[model samples]
Target: MPIPAMTEQSDPLCLSEVTAAALLFDAPWRRFGVVGDSLSAGVGDPTPGYTNKGWADRVANVLQRVCPDVQYLNTSEFGVTTARTVAHQLDRMAEFGPDLLHLPCGPNDILRRKPDFDEIEKTMRRMYDLAARTRALLTTFTLGRAYVVPTFPDWDERIRAMNAITRRLGAEYEAVVVDMWNHPVNDRDNLLSEDRIHFSTSGQAVMATEVVRQLVYMLSSRTSE
Candidate 1:
């Protein structure tokens, strides 16, 4: 069965009807790049045809529907940290020269036994600087919902601290920030997979919808200026 496209009328996690309409972009995107860890590599979506079809793929599909010329590339891997991404993924993502770059790291880093905040911030800044050099519309997100918070008693605090740094980095680097804490999708359940660590199929759809909405709004606003 084909996964249904997200529309405000049919969306389970709808923020508003008009929000979907706003995602209809006037100017098309050419190239889109994705960087991060397993989420970016699409770990939980499915292996329908032996390919990991996750949220990033869903977002790319939506972009291609409106802008067929858009090319997509994802350099994310499982268990990758901000430090590893800066060392391994940043240069390659910049080489892609995507019109828009979606970066979602820090999850893997924060999940570690001993996460170094200073190192995380520095590595993230390096990644941000590399993206800035490309002049691509760099975007990132925060984690406010974790299914396995109980497993790691201290994870909530670490996630909160990480989110703060993410917002600050977005502001300092002028990258687009997807504020998940304020997004309506958080109100919904069954979005996460059985493990609760990764997004479920439905969750992936919501995420893709959010990414498209933000990208369209950001691009349109820039064009108007």
Candidate 2:
């Protein structure tokens, strides 16, 4: 079946909605730190009617609204792999001493001709371990099914493996996992950017909304405990 077109108006979760969802968390985080690749950096093409900000920036914006003192730092670089993130970004994020941290996934790790799943997992574990040391509430996103690379016939399989690692580690570390593998947004024809890799700004908006929702759930679970 052909995918449907996604416009800014039709988006179920927009930046405004992200703001509303973030407000649901009464306790404000003082420091928000993000470290990883372009996804963590919120790199994507701007959709005509959507906000140009990436998911991290949008989330940070709403977070700042609730707590104007929130200090935001994003050390995400384009095309950086999991290993690179560990070697480079981890220490900086640690130094930032964030109370809320967004971890990177394994997208760049799976981009090569022969991705070593074991090594990818190892590096990812290292990142998670180090980030967890800060005692911050960790968060991550499982890659959406719409993020595809046609040149690689096994792209779906790679994404699945990477997402599995993400889910497993997220659970192990008690992180908020925003599972988007089967999201309806993935069925949108325009979900991807011109690079056919990253999601467009419309998708980013949806992601920000989901992140806030997950954070709210986490907070609620904590309150119930």
Candidate 3:
């Protein structure tokens, strides 16, 4: 099926709506830490009508509104792979002692000419193992279908493999997985930035909204339980 034309008015969710959704969660998280690649860094190009802030920052801002004392530490860097993230970012995150943590899903791991899924899984498991020791509410997002690498003809397959690994690890660690594989936002024509890789600010807004909603669901489920 073809995606419909997208316009400024066609954005699925606005920043105000993201804030509103976040306000619904009476979350207990006062410390948030994020680590991994550019995705974890919330890298994106600015859209005409959307805020340039990445999803992580937007989420952090919302959390700050809910808990004024909330401390956010994002040790993510652009162009870093999963293994490098484990090496460089994990210690800082552990030291920060976050009550809420966001881990990477290894988008860069599969960007290589011949990605070693076995090594990727091993490294990811190690990363998660260390992260779980922090006893934080872990969170991550699967890659959106809109994210692509024209150079890699098998990009879609690589993404599927990567997302599967993410889902599996996320489940093992009891992490909140904001599955974005086939999200409606992926249908937008303006989803990607000029790099044709990273999401645009519009996509970032939608991502932040979804993350808030998922966190609310987790909180709500705990309350009911």
How many backbone clashes are present in model 3? 0
Model 2 lDDT on a 0 to 1 scale: 0.87
Report residue 178 deviation for candidate 1 (angstroms). Answer: 1.1
Model 1: which ten-residue window has the lowest total lDDT?
44-53
Better of 1 and 3 by lDDT: 3
Q: Provide the lDDT at 119 for model 1.
A: 86
Query: Taking the tens digit of each residue's C-alpha lDDT, what string does model 2 give over 1-225?
Result: 987655556666554744554456495689999999999998999887787889999888888778778899999999999889999988988999999999988888998998999988988998999999999999999999888888799999999999999999999999999999998888877788999889989888889888887887788888899
Give lDDT per model, in order.
0.72, 0.87, 0.88
Q: What is the clash tally of candidate 2? A: 0
Which residue pairs in model 3 clash with each other?
none
What would the per-residue lDDT of candidate 3 be over residues 117-211, giving only the tens digit for each residue? 99999999999999999999999999999888889999989999999999999998999999999988888888899998899888888888888
Flag the better candidate by TM-score, 1 or 2.
2
- What lDDT is reached at residue 64 by model 1? 70
Better of 2 and 3 by lDDT: 3
lDDT of 1 by residue, 1-225 (tens): 998655434666533323443465564567889998987776674412222347677767666766778899999988888888888987888888888888875888787777889888988888888878888878887774643556678977887888898999998987878777556665556456667687665556666667667777777788899
